[model samples]
Target: MEFENRDEYIIKKYQQDEETMIQLYVQWCSNHQIDPIALYQRAYPGQVQNESLLKAVEEKDQESIEISSDTLLEVLQMFGNDDLAFAVTEEIQKRSKR
Candidate 1:
């Protein structure tokens, strides 16, 4: 995931291979019938060591990285999470407009 200044190819490769993680996330969220947008807000407990996505935001950080438009569709497809992608896009848009 979040290698600082890494090659684009490497990031995509990782995203493709470990995509099951996101798939699992989608399935779980769907089963819970939870608002996907709400999931973005609940604080994750403890230090989560996500080997992929390569970076984790601290509990206090509100701004997430802009998922590049070129890779946006790929990310949506990879996780079967259009809602999450849209939510992220909305945040990015709101921040940009600010």
Candidate 2:
């Protein structure tokens, strides 16, 4: 409950809750009907998109996609969704044991 280093905690928490973060990203992509990897590429030109993520989106295979914790944070932050990003990070820490 007490994090001496909050940023470190957040990073570790994100890694632990990677599945939930990926699910949230998939839901967001589905709701917006936009491939998150593409969107990320557009947002940060010259940045390589994740091939697996692109393939998953192209194939409409949500279950096969795996999103990195950093990418999840970046995409969410890029879309101006600090609250959801924070929630996902916190949820990862909270639900890690389950």
How does each model score on TM-score? 0.33, 0.38
Candidate 2 local lDDT, residue 35: 55
Error of 2 at 30 (Å): 1.0
> Model 1: runs farther than 4 Å from truth?
1-16, 19-67
Candidate 1 per-residue lDDT, tens place, 1-98, comes to 55554778778877666554444433333443433334444322243534432322122124333334436546565656565556656654665697
Model 1 weakest lDDT span, ten residues long: 52-61
Deviation (Å) of 77 in candidate 2: 3.4
Quote the lDDT for 25 in model 1: 38
